[model samples]
Target: MMATTHALAGVALAVLVGVLFPESAAGTSLLPVAAAALGGLFPDFDLYAGHRRTLHFPVYFSVAAAVAVAVAVAVPTVTTVAAALFLVAAGLHSAMDALGGGLELKPWLGTSDRAVYSHYHRRWIRPRRWIRYDGAPEDLLAAGAFALPALYVLDGTARTVVLGALGISAGYVLLRKPMVEVTQAVVDALPDEHLDRLPARFVEDFR
Candidate 1:
């Protein structure tokens, strides 16, 4: 899924948490929403290094999130609620990767088997391809689906953020395939030395 999609999913989860626990700090402040959105984007930060393998701990994050949720429920401070939402969002992002296309230059081609890394299992999980690929039309739909409740419930800055994400998601869906082509063109024109420094996926298929 697109980063926006993941962020929206996190926001949706936070909103759900707020609805379920109206008296909690999560319902009163945007901190937990922000935390969850950031957490959703956190795992993708490893995109340059190991991609899915570096920080996408599907099992471990889920376990930690479970514990964190328990702690938050027991005390329900702003800090605990934010922390719990963060872990839960991160875990959700990691696990949700399995439902998308694989990690490759052209994931829509269905060529790669690896969707996300599972350190606990010491292997890669295969892509389910339910959404085909990030930035696909279906991905935009998924983003919209997650954004609905958030847009309905949130106001001020949070609502603006969701709108911005929706716009970005729409633009990305249009450019996703073209961006890959442009990257390939740029990579093809680069010198061998520079190409060597680029990520393997960028050069491997072009070479």
Candidate 2:
């Protein structure tokens, strides 16, 4: 799935959390929402590490979160916030990736030969691999399903942002293929220095 979809999922989940647990500090904190949104983007950083191997491990993050919580006793404000953010953001990031039939979980306990693809599904229902990495029609449908309801609950600025995010996500799903083709064609026609100066992620996408 696309990063935008994951991000919106994280935000929507954070909102739901707030609704469900309004009295909890973590639920009320903007940090968790920001962290969740950012966390939705975090797992993709594996692109720089080893794509879908190390950072995608659920146990690894769980242990790290445990440590953070343990240390929070000494610094309640900072560590408490950090722990919540890490759990919500990174946790959901890996989970969304896993749903797409990717992600290597429990990497420490098992060798690469034994690594498992983590997912959420039942025997009666298929997993979330209905869409590919980018430009899946399913992405729009799923995101809209979540985003539209969020609009009804979120008020003022949050509602506006969600609406804007929905537009961008929909645009990306619809235009990604054509945009990639056009972008690559434009980049191909550029001179060496201009191409070299382009952002690495943007250039890498074409390759």
Candidate 3:
């Protein structure tokens, strides 16, 4: 799944939880909702360091949830909202990654990545090649399905959750190839000496 998909899932899960348990849902304030939606992107932060191995770990969210719950014991209203948002974001992110065959789940923990993915791999029971990162019809369809509720259910800053999802999907579809070409062109134009100084991943991917 792509970042847009993860973000859309975050918003959809938040709203679904809100509808399912109205009493426990976040308030009209956008902070809680925003927190959860943004958390969707948190796991990907590891791209700067270890990709899907550091920030992508489920334990990080568990700790955040635990802290939120503890805080809720004292400040029920605000903390409850934060907790719900965080859970939806982290939970959905992990689930999507696992299903997409992109999750390793052993960041900072002494766990086996192969073991984790192998267990999750059983859920699909098909070849791994079928799982694409983006540009699949299913990605578009899923984005549309999730966006409908987000666009109509919340307004102002809240609406941005779904709106941003839609925008990201559209942008990716419209720009990914062109951007890749542009990046490749730039890399091609650069001298070999400069390329040698670039990050190994960048050089390998574009060269």
Once superposed on the true structure, which residue ranges of model 3 sit more than 4 Å away at CA?
A: 59-75, 101-131
* lDDT accuracy of residue 61 in candidate 2: 60
Any residue pairs clashing in model 2, and if so which? none
Number of the predicted model whose lDDT against the real structure is largest: 1
Q: Evaluate candidate 2 by giving its C-alpha RMSD to the native, one decimal.
A: 8.2
> How far is 13's C-alpha from truth in model 1 (Å)?
0.3
Better of 2 and 3 by TM-score: 3
What are the runs in model 1 whose C-alpha is more than 4 Å off?
Answer: none
Ten contiguous residues with the weakest lDDT in model 1? 198-207
Give lDDT tens digits, candidate 3, residues 176-196. 556767877888899998987
- Compose the digit string of candidate 1's lDDT tens values, residues 1-207: 999999999999999989888888879989999999988989999988999999999999999999999999898899999999999999999999999999988998999999999999999999999999999999999999999989999999889999999999999999999999998888888988887788888887777
Residue 179 in model 1: lDDT: 95
What does the lDDT read for residue 89 in candidate 1? 95
TM-scores of all predicted structures:
0.98, 0.64, 0.72
After TM-score superposition, what is the CA distance of residue 157 in candidate 2 from its true location, in Å?
1.5
Q: Global CA lDDT of candidate 1, please? A: 0.93
* Candidate 1 lDDT for residue 9: 91
**Collision pairs in model 3:** none
Q: What is the Cα-based TM-score of model 2?
A: 0.64
